[model samples]
Target: DDILPDGFTKVKPRKTRRNKTDTTGFPPLPPPKSQSETSHSTASDSNKQPVPNLSVTSTPSTSQVPEDTTAQPPRKVRVTPIVLRDASRWRGVNHKFISLGIKFERAVAVDAGIRIIPKSEDDYRRIIRLFREEEVPHHTFPLPSERNIHAVIRGVHATLSEIEIKEELQQRGYSPLHIIRLKRGGGVPMPLVVVILPKVEKSQQLFNEHELLGLAIRVEVQKNSRLIGQCHRCQKYGHAQSYCTAPPKCLKCASDHMIHLCPQTEQEERKCANCGGGHPANSRTCRFAPKKNLEVIAQRRNVSYADAARDATRAAPSVGSSANTQNVDLATALRSLQQIIGPLISATQALQAIFPANG
Candidate 1:
């Protein structure tokens, strides 16, 4: 090989290049279905249109709409963080933290720390200035505000379809949830529907039987588990972390390097991504995880998993269910399988969490 000119270096052409399409406009959309198809759809779904989902405002694709605040239920103003120096030796107090005519609902403790929930926006604003008091525990700012209510709907007949459920809810004149999913339990055709409600207030109404198209379905509303996300790699939420597309961050120190390759020698000095605390970010103990999870929730909602599993566009199972087998991607197939066994998997996970195997 001959010596190249100064600053010249050997170069190899990229073997793989993304195919670029030169076009001035987007491809044409599919033609609208005929009136017969529309009529048939209307008839099949009992003439009710899909209700407007409200929680989708967090998605990047969705623009926030101005709604009458007076019309809606009480909004979650913010989460105020508090830290107790002696978390283990702390005594439970019944009274609310009051200051300047402002009152916090209650102190929810985690470890030796607690987070205060102000009654409303007005209270939060009033207490904002005096929030960081010198006497009480350290009150932190900007906690995750979005709240979730998990409910398992029962008494839905095997024949009760997703479309019918949506139609029924819409007919009831309730603000529709962004996601109301039916997770199939085992080999059963009918599934247990897990609804993610936009408001915590919905939990009260759920205690009563919900009449969905003559089917008096009972909704058992419970607080969201707020379980740490299962990492795609490790399968446990608060364990080995995988950045996936990005470079892995150190689980201990939260540095630029991987956990194993972390150069910081002090193992005791752990820092979390969720909270600026001395612990791994993956730890379930991180009180800040819930707030961080709200962002994750918003990101996950981009895809309509329930509808994808339902595959309404595909021919009815009667015609030929296996017709699309050749065209299905790995993710789609996985999603379909997940839809079938999600309830079982969830229950199993819950059991596992409750009773971890002894090493």
Candidate 2:
């Protein structure tokens, strides 16, 4: 008991911290339960129903998940194009079609006439019937495509008429659309016929040789002539005016107008739309014209334009070399003639000398 001053007081001793396992500061816990009480509590818990946990979500297993089977989009349908020859009556024809509720894919104005694309074969047949009923001038020839097969039949006698050839082809279980005799440049008929056939599984059979009118005829696939299509409207190659989507271009002056609407006279200076030359767009002498043919051949043969051009260059004979070769041949011919003539002259002189006494 220490005495302190009037303004000061004695300090009490501080208590030490309790150990981590000590629970003296906290409220005393209940005593440990007996084994029987623990067993009873566990049994009660097992009998009680479990309350669903709203806060915690359980994800579904992969095996329990449903698969997605969404359908794919439909494929595009192919359309066939048909040309109408009478362009002047196209407006009336279009109006009539619309009035009749006739459905077509589309129609475009072309130099030949109106080119109408139909959605189905039924529509094509219907249009053809309508044209024939109306006495309209129209050509229904199919364009060169995979579906159209053209073959050349050689050794067909000119005396055999077209009707006879058609009959013969039909008798051979084959369908022939048109059989025309081929002709030379001067309209001289040749012993060859061009046959147009529809594409079928047995279309290749036409390439085999066949006997016709007691004469064996050879058949061959018609080779592509590498002919390019020139669009009269745009004055461009690789496409025709009927299917051309380009704007009109004048052939005479390369103006933005049709040939019939061109204001230039015959005496006016001509301008080409393709090469910008003095000639018209369709001139045969254009340097760029051969490129168009190459493009056509490349597309038909499934080759590149450069490769086609290289092949054409290799196939064409050199003019200078050909002329030199002709000159060499002529000189050789002259030398051979001189050698034969000299020997003959010497023999004739010797014979005359031997027969001098008789003279």
Candidate 3:
């Protein structure tokens, strides 16, 4: 090394580089090929190593699956509320109120061929009272002249069946009822048989739309206990009271054929007054005895049976017609008549009330 110029430094001899093949030979021996390959190879070189052992298996390709156009998303299910029709058909019919123990109550009848019902017992009572008080004239306002279906839908509390509904209508003196089907909430149409009762406009007007629906619901839930036995004492249908055995005495006389059908018992039993004993003071036979028949001595006195009988009564000895005598006679007659036909009259009245001619 020697210092030459001010900017020059000491010079040293450079080292020579090695050749590429001598520095890093091939990646390592590839090893020999297979025996089968060796037989076909042109030459087997030791420098070249055999191929590494590795599994090479081909996987079958899969085609892309086409999207399913028919597969649909799950549909939303919705339950529609049921709307009832023919509810008003059972109006004016009689229904048994189990809670109240009333065998019969005026039911909401039909308007335009539909039955309607009240919501609560109060409403029912109010409606019934209105019908009774108003009668035919209850609704003074002119009705909607057009035929409109008066439907009452059963609500959540419905319990009545079609048969029971029909029976109730019949009991209230309605002939028959029809069950028709109506769709609820615009979904499916269902059978909705209508039980038509007496149509009273007055009563119908009292109910609002909701009340009418409720009433129909109530009717649907009503139950009917079938009529079976008969009351022997009353000689009527229904249940027979334990006391409904044979009469103790003859209803006509106090005889053992009722012990001659006792007058006091007959009166108590609401029997005909004329048949009982005519008078509490006299027996039935004596009270019904014909008046004294007086014969006319002269042929010229020929008279009709009515006139002759009248004449005989007039001629007969009588203390005088007094208020007390007349009262006694009338009382006796009434008691006798009551004993004979009282039950019949009662039955007739009941029939009339249940099925009024106009009703």
Candidate 4:
């Protein structure tokens, strides 16, 4: 007990109770709710609004969505090229074309002339007609690559006309653009017929034997006779004289003049300009002659000129090695002949001894 001042009060400490441990290993659980309490809690839950699921999403149907038209790429158009000869004479040709409302894809200067590529067939025809109307010298023929594939059919009777052959081919489900009667020198017709067909898989089927008018005829791919162009103006291979801009070169002596104007006579030694060989430049015997034809082989085989040249170089034997190879082959042939002759002579002598001659 203590003496208290006026308006002063004493306070007592509060007591805490200690929790008792369960004899079982598990802790004690809460008591179950009463039936009325549970019913009341269920009623409260039913009254509460349901929460929406933020993770779930729904997509629109394909039929309801608009297509993306801008996503697609545009198709490209194929253009045809046309060549105009003597480009120098066709000055201001582009302006003239513009005035005439002619449309072209592009124009490129080539060795022959101006090569104009038109966007459409209508423009191609219009350009051709314009050239014809102006009396301009232009080549309208398609390039070798642009032309349809050609195949030769042999064993066909010369008496059969082109129309008859074409009709027969049509019956066999082949659409031939043209049929030509192959002729020899001096216009003498041969049994061979050249058929021009479209560049399709079916066209290859023609390279086989077929029955025509009760006779079996064989067909083969028409190979190009000359693979390179020879320029008459310069007496060089690769281009024609009309398109050649090179200076005149004589074929006889390879001089820097026209063949007719060559001062060199036949009595003088012949010289080749291309290979400096003893023969003429245009001679088939020239070492470089095969190189000129490589272009044609490359074009027909659909390979690059460099690849064809490499193949040709590897195939062609060197002059010195060729001579040695010929000598070796000749000696081998002689030895084989001697071996054969010795056996033959022995057989003949034996036969003679067995049967004596009446004389």
Q: Which structure among the candidates has the greatest TM-score?
A: 4
- What is the C-alpha local distance difference test score of candidate 3? 0.40
My TM-score estimates for the predictions, one after another, are 0.28, 0.38, 0.14, 0.39
| lDDT per residue (tens digit) for residues 12-131 in model 4 | 566785777888878789789999999999999999999878875668889979988786676866565766767886567788888988888888898657888886777877887777
Model 1, C-alpha of 273: deviation from truth (Å): 14
- The runs of at least 3 residues in candidate 4 whose Cα sits more than 4 Å from the true structure, single-residue gaps closed, are 1-71, 141-149, 154-192, 197-209, 218-292, 295-359
Give the TM-score comparing model 1 with the true structure, all chains together.
0.28
For model 3 the local lDDT of residue 262 reads 39
- lDDT (C-alpha) at residue 111 in model 3: 30
Q: What is the lDDT of residue 49 in candidate 3?
A: 85
Each model's total of backbone clashes = 1, 0, 72, 0
The candidate with the higher TM-score, 2 or 3, is 2
RMSD of each: 38.8, 18.0, 34.6, 19.1
Deviation in angstroms for 125 in model 1? 8.8
In terms of TM-score, how similar is model 2 to the real structure? 0.38
Backbone clash tally (model 1): 1
Worst 10 residues of 4 by lDDT: 316-325
Candidate 4: lDDT over CA atoms? 0.74
lDDT at 184, model 3: 58
lDDT of 1 by residue, 1-359 (tens): 33468857767676896756748567656679999998898798885778778765545433555555687677754544333323432343222233245666765776424445666655664544443342333323333444455667777776777677766666665444643555442334454566555565644475575666777777786544554453322222432222222234556666666554756544246776446677665554456444445444444656354443334224222111233233345557789889989899899999999999999
lDDT of 2 by residue, 69-169 (tens): 88878996656676776688787877877786667898888765677887666777677677778766554434334356889998998888889998988
Single out the weakest 10-residue window by summed lDDT for candidate 3: 136-145
